[model samples]
Target: MIKKPLFPYNPKYPSVADLKRRAKWRIPKFAFDYLQGGCNEELNLERNESDFDNIYLKPHYLKTGGEIDMSVELFGRTYSAPFGISPIGLQGLMWPNAPEILAKAAAKHDIPYTLSTVSTSSIERIAEVSDGKAWFQLYHPTEDRLRDDILNRLKSVSCPVLVVLIDVPSFGLRYREIKSGLSMPPKMNIENIFQAMICPEWGIKTLQHGIPSFATLKPYMEKGLDLSQLGQFMNKTFTGKVNMEKVKAIRDLWPGPLVLKGVASEEDMEGAISLGVDGVIISNHGGRQIDAGESSLISLIKLANNPKYTGKVKIMMDGGIRSGVDLGRAHAVGSEFNFMGRPFMYGVGALGDEGADHTINMFKAQLYQVMQQLTLEKVSDFPTRLIR
Candidate 1:
């Protein structure tokens, strides 16, 4: 018989913040820091969430309302909601089998889940779990053969959308990661081992799932490579910067919808349009890169309002969005869709396999509440409710 989850969605832990608090205690400090830390002073990280408060919505209490329709249509598909799971790397490090867990949840809920190229689960594994509904995020590889191989693997799985990440031209200077000695094969010092011992649940689950590695890239990696070699391999494998030639190459190769992620400027937006990209996710790499950059919300408002980009490409934003209210704020500001990474990880970290389902349910419930309050009847109506 299948076992049930230890804790269901409790009213006491309704918010993502609550899940985060529980996750911090349940996982090792090093792992938690990897999931939560930002680069440099983390100004951009803090600003992403704080800037959402500046947006105000005007409720239409006097207007007539019926049941709210939360479904959204994008790229010839209708998702149950307007939000999706953003790509996150090393997800299994945060919680054992997190990528698979989130993929299953997204498939069950009829929402999109973008799998990171560096995530622990392989493309084939996630494709099976998501029933071919998962999207793939490509980190431009240094070798043409490697890039072509990964894209072909995605195609064999019948992946719907391909999201190319462009922001990480270089790794962020995350101090927490530096201090914790976090690496591909996590540096298991005495302190890290002790921390794991204290978090017995995470430790046991990790053992069951096997030690998290770059599963997606394992086929190409040398067998039984040491930690130092693995680090060197990663550094040599991926070229973080994405130029026009690379974008054009990918556009020419991939037949499905192509989305350009990490777009925070008009130049990048214009480039994506020129390259004939399908969508653009206005993100600041969750403030993990470039501490002095503007928040994703700030970038979204500017891009969404400009007529030049309004109909040119499908606009989505992701960074520091904690709840459905924040989703409403994004929609009000002309964002066609939204995505979140840390929130779903917090859920899985807090409640094991069941966390993904709980987190998605929470988002739906909270979004419905916001719609009722705004006297809105459909997800598309949110833009008109803005108090601009």
Candidate 2:
């Protein structure tokens, strides 16, 4: 008989890497690469996690340890922790109805779960699962009509926060994806067949459900690549319309806290501040869009320390965090909150609905261990315990 996971859940769960391995073994090569692979050569991708490993820690064992308060307050709302599930498009491709699983898991834990503009599930579906704590990530469709409709859809779901992804003003050129035949909802061709055949578990689940599609996009377009082509057409069809004015218009409509993701430049940061946004997530789209840009960690450190950024707005970071040490290093340097795109998705891919819960437990476990050694308590203490 299969064992039951701990009741009310337990933080001392499996490792995120374990989930990654399980996900890899469960999905086709195309799907696995979509979760794991990054841009050309993936040097930046490897560097993102390895950079965290390079940072050292100094323990203070003699200090009287206290309670670990993981709760955080950001943009006038309190969260259970400083980390959240970052958005990924078409999550159902990894697991059947993945967005719902992520949203439900995040809600059960009282954390934020961001919904991608391209998610397989609708915003309203997330609202039902996440109880309106869901955050919406906007990609800024090129057409005003389409964009407004999307925003209205998010509002209908009663989402509390809006995170606009600006890093992908245009999609990045990812060589690994190209080599892997990575497509949204994926293309089930002769090549993908061999890939599925290799992963019997993934293939069986996929066959049972008839393969994941861009369910949200299906109503707008026909089946298979035809629908995908329509989405691509819409993207190219409206690229020129997504500008500062477009962003401002969105700001005017959405009355909740607005944060901008993919912010990499001082001017962009300044622009977000000018727009009167609530916060900014310093990210390089998880090193997904650009090849030469600095990691969000370096960018966050610079932006947070800058006199201009002092209390002007909240500063957060993504793109390199893998463990509590990484999250601690980022907080020590300057970042306040963080988001992880692939890791959480990997959880869902690895174990279907249970993936997000397992991944969150694993990360919490890693963080707890880090705290045990550092003689620290509470996530807030991370900023003060910095060491070279």
Candidate 3:
């Protein structure tokens, strides 16, 4: 007998691509561009998705399985799935209350939800929504005092893991944002206003939520700063590259699992292992950081195949993953864990409150179908099916 999907999702938008297509029309073009565009020429963005085509998994037709168990353990806790939501800054800008929507859905689904420091939701708010199981991704503040304060806040809420971003030494040059006036110190032009007017649903939601601001950082910011002033404040607050010293400092301060994100090379992987980090997320800031850099999957293959770093630390990856099939592909290539950013946002953008749940369920269903086809009983068994 065939098994039914564990979670119910909208059949109308069954895949991430469907959600993306619907989202393009539901939200303003500026918002859609921000959610979709990568840095510079977007070559890296194209490569991030296109590179997955190179990965192929072998299917076994004769073998039988007891059951496909999707649950995986990380940082002393078992999550419902091997994948989690990646941290996306300004989440509310794309869809009002996006972070909260994702957090609640993650809690209900029993998967990890990572909240960005610059996201439009407060740490406490996300913690409340996710039952304090959410992971916090810090952007590495320039001031030690601010860093300590943020750490203390995380401690108070019992945040499970702390992910420090190391890839963005400087913000990448995104041409779309520059052209749309979403560059640092954003502007509200006539075109932008007209775009918003045409998207009545988005405009209504924006009115209900008020203007999207950095909810987590509002305490540190002065009252009533305009767009340009807000940009200047952000630049001044987080104006340095995250170095070894900074990671070491964060490692010493936080007692829980500490992960360094934006790792693209073996050299950086070596550095992370030396610092005694709990894990390292192989990422290129989802192809938003350096346009000329290698695709994240290529970087993952290099680190995963290296003998020296094997089993030294937990190696995870995130980039170009749009479906359960892509998640399986990443696993086959040695990604111990996986995360996705834009797909979830697209779900919320296209479906509103139900979007996160639909996206999560869709991924779960797709992965289950793939595993059943391969007679694969576990997610870790994917590497054995890798066409290496």
lDDT of 3 at 158: 99
Compared with the true structure, the alpha-carbon lDDT of candidate 1 equals 0.92
lDDT, candidate 1, 1-388, per-residue tens = 9776332456767999999999999999999999999999899999999999999999989999998889998999999999999999999988999999999999999999999999999999999999999999999999989999999999999999999999999999998888888954458899888988999999998999999988999989999899989988999998468999999999999999999999999899899999999999999999999999999999999998899987889999999899989999999998999999999999999989889999998898888889989999888888898888
Candidate 2 Cα errors over 4 Å, as ranges = 1-13, 183-186, 207-210, 222-228, 237-242
Residue pairs clashing, model 1: none
User: Would you list the rank order by lDDT, best first?
Assistant: 3, 1, 2
Clashing pairs in 3: none
What is the TM-score (0 to 1) of candidate 1? 0.97
Candidate lDDT scores, in order, read 0.92, 0.76, 0.93
The superposed Cα distance between candidate 2 and the true structure at residue 208, in angstroms, equals 5.0
What local lDDT does model 3 show for residue 61? 92
Q: Which residue segments of model 3 deviate by more than 4 Å?
A: 1-4
For residues 275-368, what per-residue lDDT tens digits would candidate 3 score against the true structure? 9999999999878888999899999999988999999999999899988899999999899999999999999999999999999999999999
Each model's total of backbone clashes: 0, 3, 0
Clashes of 3: 0
RMSD of each: 3.3, 3.3, 1.2
How many clashes in candidate 2? 3
1-388 per-residue lDDT for model 2 (tens digits): 9776422223333556666777777777777777677776666676677767655667888999987777789877788778899988767776667788889999988778998877777777788889888998887766677677777877777778999878766676787667666643235678878887887766666676665554544455545556467557656643552457877998998888889887878999999999998899988877777667777777787798799888888888888787766877777777788888788877787777677787777777667778778877877677667765
Candidate 3 C-alpha error for residue 157, in Å: 0.3
